[model samples]
Target: MNSNVIPFDFDGQPVHFSLDGWLNATKIAARLGKEPTAWLRKIETLEYISFMAEALGFNSVPGTELEEIKALGTSAPGVKKRILELSKSTGMVRSRAGSSGGTWLHPKLAIVFARWLNTRFSVWCDLKIDSILHGEMSTRVQLDRACKALEDRKSQASQDGKGLSSWRWDRSSLEQSVGYWLGQVQMTLDLDAA
Candidate 1:
């Protein structure tokens, strides 16, 4: 394995973890407190199922085909069903003949799965996913700064006789300023901005 890759145990299943992160069906099942196969069967979308299958290295389709399928989005029920059938027939979710096969999921999907299973797990996964998507900055510091900035703006608006309730900062502006700081850190470290 490359030095950049790390190993993670999702419950009892060993995962080839990357900076981008992945979750396996076994782990999701564990987290959801459901049987793995049963849980997978219950998942509504073929795209989710297929993504998990591909991430686990089970899907036989070419990478380009997979990418194209992903680009098509998950709204078409017919397409999703057809893809799901093909994936299943091709043994997409099953591991090799003799091993404990499992499905692997991207961090985003993992977060979604967690959300579906448990609110607390969802919150935890959201924080982890946020750190992965956004660079790791001290959230407390950024939050404090944002809060202070908002307060100052509110104070100024009040002094000008603008009703405090109506004097609100746009959510996007706040996000941009905080995101700007995050971008600066990323630029300094030469990290990709998510």
Candidate 2:
């Protein structure tokens, strides 16, 4: 009942709309009782509905040409016309001219529109974040930063050796955790002996 909350029906249970994002359980649950074709369409329609709702709200989504109005500027006029018709058939409407020259929701269906819009936005953000943090670039960058920090710690360790015991100086947590100081000492001592 709260203005901030959006609720949806899930397997005969009323569930609160999540701001916490991208859970697969709802999708799985929604498909449980339907025929495969019906279930597939239901999930695809939800994704399509979400993208359509998001595009109307000044969002730049990677939807099909029909769902993304910005895509219309490049396509032929006849094709744009048909895409608009397809949008309306799928329960969306388009606007023309000035600041409001984009698609819009049927006034009677605003709540459904908003729920889908927020879900789409969240999903887009999640994809971007996942791409950044899960790639080879991210792995290389993180390891490079750690190695630089480790070198600085080794320099500090050599300076600390002038004072007395290895434990006396301020040490990196990694040195404490994995006995890096002792490993470095062993390497240095072996080199000196050779």
Query: Tens-digit lDDT track for model 1 on 1-194?
Result: 13223333334433332345554546456645765444433325345656665676665455565566567655645555555554555354433221333555556456666666677756755655555456554643464487677667767767865545456645457657767765654453334433
Candidate 1: which pairs clash? none
Query: CA lDDT, every prediction?
Result: 0.52, 0.38
Q: What does candidate 2's lDDT look like per residue over 64-175, in tens digits?
A: 6434454444244554444434444554443334332223333323333333435543343344224333423433344445556666766776676663355345455644
Best by lDDT: 1
TM-score of each: 0.37, 0.19
Clashes of each: 0, 0
